[model samples]
Target: MKRFYIYLLAFLLPVCCLAQETVIIKRKLTNAVKERVSVLKSDNVTKQGLYQALWDSKTVLANGSYTKNVKTGIWNFYDTKNNVIQRFNYTTNTLLYEAPEDSATNCRYVVDHTVRDTDRTTKPIVIGGRFFGYINYLRLFRLPPDMRNINNEVVVPTIELLVSPGGRLAEYIVHFQAENYDRKVGFNIDYLSDEDKTFIPATINGEPIACRIFIRCFLTSGGDLDLF
Candidate 1:
């Protein structure tokens, strides 16, 4: 009887340890975004549970789950105002829902302005969705040393992204204007990561086409860039 009890305890120990092996990690992302990831350590460390990205450490920007580090099931992405902007299903590779395009919100333009308004057009979008893409942009953007402190004045800056039909970033330009400052900065796209350069190319009349995306942002006195 003692040998049998010992064998049973040994058999259950590994299972109990595995059940409690879940690890939670929290980290800060660019622009005050917070990421909380739950991973499981078994044969290897894998993200196997809830994943959340919060904006400003409070508003939920993204909420989803992962299996084997791949996004699975439905994922919800929200705007800074906490409104659901997109719903995607990674398991099925489907865009379940996307908010209607509002020109007042984001700027978009086709490379060829000759396209008629009646034509069906879709704007280019970053590969990993908007929240992550915005975060990446914030992480890479660096303010010029002289422009870092605005002294409570609002400074408008425009970021232009020229995307090719192949979904590559052909050109990146930044335009800044203030009381006595007017500068245009261009970056070599080759220096950017492949993931950053890739996007879902814009389409016109069901055909892929090159386009330009303009992101309007303002620099606060605190030196933080806020997108409109």
Candidate 2:
């Protein structure tokens, strides 16, 4: 009887220790492309899949934390595999910022969002061009109801570019013109400092990029906003 009890104790001890050991489950990766849909499907994870996901979440930046915040403010959104998905200028409230300009002046302007399709992939990836995420305009000087304003139908110019290692934009080029309000310019209006509003960078065709926007608007000689 003593020998049998000893044997049973030895067998149960290893079993109990094995049971207490942490078992890591893993999962496999599937499609990495971002397909826009009316409704997104819930991701189904498997044990192997989870393992691959854990490995992928590791950050490339050695000094940064792998765990990201519920990042508000300006953020470049990437997938679990680290491919940039989109760019966002998030805010908790309807926060307003200055329209970028060299000088301060009131003008009529229209905001337009742009998207770009890049050909650097096996298939073209649709990264957002600058201004893809959000668009807004302001009448620094309110226009009179009867005044014909040029911003009503002006085409604004914009440039898209990538940042270089030298902290400057590389291969920077104008991407597209933004649609203007339904009006025309009567005269060559002069602009003041602080009258330009630049849009935050967006991903076009899946790659991150930046842009420069020229706000097209009509400013009366007397500093009144006019829609042309």
Candidate 3:
């Protein structure tokens, strides 16, 4: 039996209901290419198979039912493994449940969560017109003076990248105390005089939405940086 439980997401609606069961899913996913659906079968004269075939052909980002084009009912979102990573209620436009990030979260998996900002249709490409990927972005990292002093070692930290809907760099947070750099290496993104946070907007529905980009940054001792 496929059991389905509906619980209001506490973060989205704290007062909806107090008696709630929670399922924490922490996993990683990579966006897979859209699959091509087979030809419509209505012309083939099978009426019974029409609806089911259409449902199978649908490839909507937010899968749900629509009444006169207005979204309604529950929608289940899937990951690369076809697992339900997230489920939302379109009637309220509220999140019902989402999987939490696990130790296995990596670039190899399909990203069903915004913890890495993959929901956006576009990811940031390399400065020189290279494709959008973590490894490509890391190669462009050239650290400022305060990043490190060690010659060959590297410091990895959780970086919070914020950008405007118009694709301008808004602010960045570097966890100075992260990894092994307690006080030896640090720089304030807030203090930068030059505008450095330029990025590719994560767009959807033909419009840009502000999003948070979180990634592990490797600040090398030779003024080089790598991101994983």
Residue-by-residue lDDT tens digits, candidate 2, 37-122: 11112222211111112212352101111112222344343333344444434334222332232243211221133433543211
Q: Residue 61 error for model 2, in Å?
A: 42
Q: Model-by-model lDDT, in order?
A: 0.75, 0.29, 0.41
The local distance difference test score of model 3 is: 0.41
Cα RMSD of predicted structure 2: 18.7
Q: Residue 97 of model 3: what lDDT?
A: 66
- Candidate 2, lDDT over the whole model: 0.29
Candidate 1 root-mean-square deviation in Å: 4.1
Tell me the spans in candidate 1 whose CA falls farther than 4 Å from its real position.
Answer: 1-20, 40-46, 127-132, 146-152, 188-193, 220-224
TM-score of candidate 3 on Cα atoms, chains taken together: 0.30
- Clashing pairs counted in every model: 0, 37, 11
Give the best candidate by lDDT.
1
lDDT for each residue of candidate 3 in 83-132, tens digit (9 for 90 to 100) = 55566665775657656546665322212335444533554321211111
Could you tell me the lDDT of residue 184 within candidate 2? 27
User: How high a TM-score does candidate 2 get?
Assistant: 0.19
